[model samples]
Target: MAAEQTSSVVLVAVDDTVLAQLVQAATTDALADEVTPPLTAGRAWTADRVAWLREFHRVRRAGLAGPTGEATWAVVVDELIVGSVRLKHTDEHGVLDMGIWLTRGARGRGVGRTATAAALRQAASLGASGVRADTTVTNTGAMAVLRRLGFHLTLSDDGQDVRALLLLDPEGTAACEVTSEPS
Candidate 1:
């Protein structure tokens, strides 16, 4: 997949050179608190950053062709890197999982929504039948963005996380429905 541009943000496919910058971005307080659980365990100092990048590379090369069946991208706005988003293939055929994180400065500005919309389009082009995502229940911002993008709440687990799904039609008329189920 190639980089995609939105009205307010750009999704640049992750590459080896951007790994270091992404590691640094992940260390930011907002990102650590909102998205990356592993990084929240401790401050992502130099060594920790290096280790994270190393593992990220070892597990999956930085591109659409990565071994992990995931496509990760660096989210940029105004030429500054703000966060990252990922789309991963699931065990269920034609289904993909989407994840995203934005820095403190980028939150509540429609960056995530725009970037995600672009990603969903990319996924549809890649033949995805549906896309799903999970967000912490407390993360109202994320939930709102997903809802606005046509993702319907499908499940709520332990009052901690909520799962949402958006079914895509090849003809481009996707329908979203919201449901609530105990995890």
Candidate 2:
């Protein structure tokens, strides 16, 4: 399935073909610290890490209804792969956990906001009732996007992590629009 571009950002379903492109972006445009754990020494993208990244997406390539009940997409802009977005079924019924990561060049642009909204809509289409995300306080951009999308955010006592939750409307209209800014 193709995601209609919003602000020049389009989400392409991650298949074997797209996976290679996604991996390239992860290795080149993104820091290993950003996308995957530091399995290798000192944030270097090693052969082991590269192999791990490939397998990570391979299991969930089935899209939403796959056995994993997870869907992942490559975030593309101007016909180039810039990032990735995904939705995974959480332990809670009707709720999904969403995550997104962008290459360094893609940050600060509105790409994240557009891709996130698209992912939420995809969740709604899968009959999900709610979506949640977890990010560090340092990730202000992601926090801002969630707030603009009408999510309720809660901060950890230590103030290092923040969690967001958005309960979609029955018709999923909540995913259709974003407020100018958080009130």
Which candidate tops lDDT?
2
lDDT per residue, candidate 2, 1-183, as tens digits? 996544467789778889899999999989888888889789888899889878888988877678888878899988899989889989998989999999998888777887888888888888889999999999888898889888899999999999999999998778557422222
Kindly list the per-residue Cα lDDT of model 1 for residues 1-183, writing each as its tens digit. Answer: 986543446777666667667666666535344544465356444555557654654465544456788877788877777887778888888889988888888777777777787678777777789999988878888888888878898555567879989889875446422121111
- Which ten contiguous residues of candidate 2 have the minimum total lDDT? 174-183
Please give each candidate's TM-score: 0.78, 0.89
Q: For every model in order, what is the number of clashing pairs?
A: 0, 0
Root-mean-square deviation per candidate: 7.5, 4.9
